[model samples]
Target: MTPTVQSLDHLVLTVADLNVTLAFYTEVLGMRAERFTPADGSQRWALRFGSQKINLHQAGAEFLPKAARPTTGSADLCFLSDTPLADWQAHLDALKISPEEGPVRRSGAEGPILSLYLRDPDGTLIELSNRL
Candidate 1:
């Protein structure tokens, strides 16, 4: 038998404010929303980020007793770009993204990783890193 392999299709995140999240993804992150639709005709919305995506379901579903609220800091998500760290920093500057910190070197990563830490509209921490 052989192990079947597949690429990561997407990542789903539940957000409290769909509009804010969508704006951040589009404006700050410079990602296009490939799809947007309301599920069940409510506040729930689906947003796509490149190949990954996040579903912002309304707060009151049976499974979700509460809406997906923002966290104190940071999401467990990391996005890598082919652009060099210096170039990424310039991009951020051009967009006025205002990173909390970094374009600093990450030691434990496999190679020379330049990273910038920032928060999304939901206060979800995001790390943008590139291997040099």
Candidate 2:
């Protein structure tokens, strides 16, 4: 019998600049930032959003045994937001970050959603969506 897979816990992101990425995630996107030193003695950072998190490894400073093809601008992640898409658009406007595409209707894990797409500091595609 196959074991059922639950929700995602975390994922790793390889970034070009840690500080810029952290600022975007914490200040603009409003996620919580955390720093830690792993067993390999390398310091790493993560941004926590709701129950999930994204661990950040600097481009050339990754801990051993990481993704074989970790690259900047490779992630395209969608995050569910409690705020309405209109409000999120205003928030992005206030932050001076332009949306790449959307308030477009799209399919989500649970149901139909309206999403706003933008790029992070390292050009990772980020989608902020609200359930319809």
Candidate 3:
């Protein structure tokens, strides 16, 4: 019998600057930043949202045996938002982060959604969306 996979637990990201990435996720996207020391005695950082998280590893100072082809600006991730799309737009405006593209319609994991696109400090494309 084959085993079935469950939901995502976390994702690892190699960032050019840890502080800049942390600031963008926490300040702009409103995620929680956490620090941890793994068994290897290496310091690690992550941004938590609800039940999911994205681990951060500095580009030049990554853990041994990382992704085979880890590079900055390589990730494109989408996040679901509970708030209204208009509110999200306003928040982005107040923060002065321009939207690369969106409030466009897009198909999500569950159903149809309205998505707003932007880039993080590392040039990773981020999509913020709300269910339609």
lDDT, candidate 1, 47-107, per-residue tens? 5656776565433331244335523223566777777767767877897878888978874
What's model 1's lDDT at 95? Answer: 77
Best to worst by TM-score, what's the order?
Answer: 3, 2, 1
- Per model, how many backbone clashes are there? 2, 0, 0
* Candidate that scores best on lDDT: 3
- Backbone clash pairs for candidate 3 read none
Q: Tell me the lDDT of model 1 at 102.
A: 90
TM-score of 3: 0.96
Write the candidate numbers in order of decreasing lDDT. Answer: 3, 2, 1
lDDT of 3 by residue, 1-132 (tens): 999998999999999999999999999999999998889988889999999989998997778778988888899999999988788889999999899998999999989999999999999999999999
Task: Write down the TM-score for model 2.
Answer: 0.94
TM-score to true structure, per model: 0.67, 0.94, 0.96
RMSD of each: 4.3, 1.2, 0.9
The C-alpha lDDT values of all candidates are 0.66, 0.90, 0.92
